[model samples]
Target chain A: MAIDERMEGIEAVFLDLDGTIYLGGELIEGASEFLDRLDHRGVKRFFLSNNSSRSVSQYLRKLTRLGIPAREEEVLLSTHDLLNWLEAEGIDDTFLVGTQGMGEMLEARGIRTQSKSPQAVVLGYDTEITYQKLSDASMYLHAGVPLVASHPDLVCPSPVGGLPDVGAYLSLFETTTGVRPVKVCGKPNPSMILGMIGELGLDVECCAMIGDSIYTDMAMADASGVHGILVLSGEATAEDAATSNVRMSLIAPSVDSLCR
Target chain B: MAIDERMEGIEAVFLDLDGTIYLGGELIEGASEFLDRLDHRGVKRFFLSNNSSRSVSQYLRKLTRLGIPAREEEVLLSTHDLLNWLEAEGIDDTFLVGTQGMGEMLEARGIRTQSKSPQAVVLGYDTEITYQKLSDASMYLHAGVPLVASHPDLVCPSPVGGLPDVGAYLSLFETTTGVRPVKVCGKPNPSMILGMIGELGLDVECCAMIGDSIYTDMAMADASGVHGILVLSGEATAEDAATSNVRMSLIAPSVDSLCR
Candidate 1:
C-alpha cells in the first residue's frame, strides 16, 4: 500500500526480466546493485518472463552473460505453466508451434509435440514459424481441435522492437478458423507466480512482483494479492500507470532504483 | 430497393464467384441457369473476388472447368485492384507473400515480385506461404516499410472448411510489426466496383452486387451506390441479414431464386 512500506514485509521478489532488470542484452544501470541488495537482504529473487520464445536454460544463459547470475530454479518461463496445463489436462499428444528448445522441454515430459493426430493445438511464441506449421495448425483447428497458447502477449519486446508473439498468432488463427484459444498460460493469470510462491513457502502478501508491464506484472500482483512494484525501464510509462485500471502498489524508475 | 424491384432496373451484375456462383469446385444449385438468365436479359456480368491467390487466367480456367464459361475480362480479382494501387503509387519493386499465380500477375505488370530490397510489402491470400516470406515481410515491416494487402477476407471458403486467407496473414503482420496495411484493395471499399463501373460506362445505380457475405458483397454495393443482392448459399444467412447494418436490396436462398 504505502510507497515506503511496499517492500516492508516482502520476502521474495518475482522480477520481470526484459523490462524490469534489463532491456535486450544490456542490464539497466544499478540493476546489478539492486539484485546484490536483494541477495544481501536475504530476499529470494526469481526471474519471471511472459516471453515464451526462450526456454529456461536460454534465460539463465542470457542472465549469466549479462552478469545477472541466475540458476535454473531462479528462472520461470511461461513454458512451465504450459507444461503444467498440458499435464493437468492429461493431454500427452499435441501439435506444438514453438521453438526446438520448447519442443525439447515438452518431449522431456513424455508429451509428443508433433503427433499427427493431436487432441489439442498448443501454440507458443513460435519465432521459427513455417507455412507448413501454420497450415497444419489451422487444419487441425478447423477440424475442431481446441487451442491452447503459451501466453496472451501480442508482442515480444526485442532490440528491433515488438515482434509478433503468440497472441498475434492466436488472432491469426481466430481469423482463419474462427477459433480462439481456450486457455492462455502466463503472467496476469496469477497462477504464474502463485505456484512458485506456494512451493517456495513464501507469503503471498510478502511476495513482490516487479515488472515494467502494468497489464501483466501489476495486474498479476493485484489479482494474486502480491505487492506489485511497477518499473519504468520498459513498456509501461508513468502516464500509462496513472490511467490503468490495474493499480500498482509501488512505482520505481527501475529495479535499479529499488532497495537503493 | 424493394424486394419485387430487385433486378428491375439493373443493367449489369457484379457477381461474387466463390459463394454466389459456386462453393469450392461444385457449382451452386441453379447458378448456371441464373447466369443464363442474366445473359438472356442482356445484363453485363463480371465475376468479382477478393481472393488474390489466383490470377485472372487461373480464375478463368477454374471457372471454365466449373462450366461457368468465364472470359478473362469477366473476372475482376483483388489482384487487379492491387496492381492499380501499386502503379498509381509508382511502386515497381515489391516483396509479395502470395501464390505463384499472383506473383506471375505482378511480374507481368513490370513489378518485381521478389526483390531483396523492396519499396513495399504486398500481401495476398498466399496458400503457398513460407516461413522465409513471413520472416522477410516481418523484417521489412519492422524497418518501417508500408504494408499493402490484396484483400481483407479472413478465411477462404473451401470444400474442407475455412482456410487462412490474407486477413489472417494481416493479423500476423500486425501482431509482429504493429503495422497495419496502408491499403486493402477489395470489397466494402466502394472503389473496388466503382472503378469497374466507370470503365464499363455502366450506371452505378443500375448495377447490382450479388454475393453471400454481407460485410463485403452487400456493403460494397451499399457504399458504391449499386443495388445489393444477398445470396444465402455461402456466408450470410437470413438471420444475419435481419440483424446486419447493411441494407439489402433483395435476399434469396441463391442467385437461382433471384431472377426466377
Candidate 2:
C-alpha cells in the first residue's frame, strides 16, 4: 500500500532523524519535500531522535541549517524522556557520562550531574566521554548503584561503519560489573511519544510512527497502538524488515515516496 | 588435612600474591615466615600474581619492602603469560589498554602498544585507564580486530571493597563490540604457572598452587595437575569453597597456617 493511502487517517506522524531523515551530514533526498507534504496535508510531524549527544537547541540549529522548518516544540529527544523518567523516579543526584551539550540540558532541569553519592548513573551518547567517566561509573556500579541509559542504540550510524553508542557502553558496564541498567528511556518505551499523543487529544488510531529502525520506531508504534511505517533509507534494509518478526504497517523506500 | 601434611612430597609451590602473601599495602601475617619455612624445607617458592598493574621489578620492590626476600626470578605475572601467548601467536603490533608499566613491559618485548592497524587489542589491569583508550579499542573491535586479555580477575582486591581489573575491562570490551578475547592468558588458563613447573623439571603431582581464589588458583591447579590449597584470606569465603565443586588439597585460614 502507498504511504499516502496508509497515512490517510493519521493525524500525527513521528519522524526519526539520522537514518530516517538524513545520513551523516547530508540531508536525505526528498526529506524536506516530505515535510512540506505533511504540512500541506495538515498532518502534524514531530522529529524524534534517540541521539543524546545534542540538545534541542543544537538540533534546532541543525534542522534550520538543513533547509527544514522545525521548531523547538517539533523536536523530541531521548534526553527529554530520560529527564522525565529521572524526575518521575525522584532522582535528583546522578553521575553522568555525556557531552557538555547534554550536561547543560540536565543541569537546567535541576539535576546534580556530578554527585559523589549519586542515586544513579545516567548514560548517554557521549562523544566527548573520558576514561574518568567510565572508571567512575564502573566503581559506582561495583558499589551497587543503578544505571539509567537514554537509549538502547548499540551504535550510531556514521559515514564510516558506525560509532559505539549507549547500547555498547551499557554492554561494557554490564560486562565489567555484571550489572545492567535498571531503566532505559527513549524509543520503544511507549512513553516517549505516547504522552504527547495523549496531550494532543489524538486517538491512537490517528497516530503513526515513521522511521528506519524496526526495533525502536516500529516497536514503539506496536506498543503504543499506532500505525508503523518503516523507511528503508538507513541501517535496515527491505530484507531485514521482511525477515523480522516486527509488524510494519507500510514499507517505503524512503519518505520520498510518501504522499506521491 | 594440614597444609604441611599435604606439602610432604611437594617440590615447588606457587604462592599467589594479594590475598595469599599480602593484602593491599600490608603483608599477611606469617606470610614471610611461610617463605622462611619453604626455604628450610629445601622447597622452591615462586610468587605468582595475576595483577598486570605492577611489573616484575615493581613486585620485587613491593615484596622487598614488605620484608619478604623475593628475587626477580621468583616472581611470575599474568603479563608474562600474556607476552608468551602473544609471541607464540605472532601478534606484535597492537593497541593496549593498560598502565605505563604494562605498556613498557609489552614494548620491551618488541610489541607496539599503540598501533592503529594492529593484530589485536591487549586488555590489562590498567590503573591509569582512560576513555580515549576505551573508545579507540571499541573502534578497533568494531573493525573486527581481535582482543587479547592478560587475565580474568574481575576485581583487584583493595582495602575498600575492590577496584575493577582486567576482567572488568574485558567485560566492557565484550559488551561494547560483542567480542570476547580470543585468548585470556592467566590463572585458570594453567599456562601461567604450568610453563614454570615444566622449566623447573617438577612433576605436576609434586607442585602446589596456594591462593585465596578458587576460580583461578584452584582451577589452574586442577588443569595443571597440581595440588590446590584454598586460603580464606581474600575474595573467597569458607562457604564459597564449601559450595564450590573445585577440589582442594587443604584449606587454611590464611597462608599464616601454611607449613606449621
Best by TM-score: 2
What is the alpha-carbon lDDT for the whole of candidate 2? 0.86
lDDT by residue (A83-129, candidate 1, tens digit) is 89899999999999998888988998999999999989999988778
Clashing pairs in model 1, backbone N/Cα/C closer than 3 A: A164-B176
Worst 10 residues of 2 chain B by lDDT: B1-10
Quote model 2's TM-score for chain B.
Answer: 0.95
Give the best candidate by DockQ.
Answer: 1
Q: Which 10 residues in a row give candidate 1 chain B its minimum summed lDDT?
A: B1-10
CAPRI quality of model 1: acceptable
How would you encode candidate 2's per-residue C-alpha lDDT over A1-260 as one tens digit per residue? Answer: 32353378778999999888888888999999888888999999999999999999999999888988688888989998999999999999999999889999999999989999999999999888665787788888888899999999887765534567888777667766778899999998888998889889998788888899999999998899888898999878988998999876888899998865
DockQ of candidate 2, scored on C-alphas against the true complex (2 decimals): 0.29
DockQ metric for all predictions: 0.42, 0.29
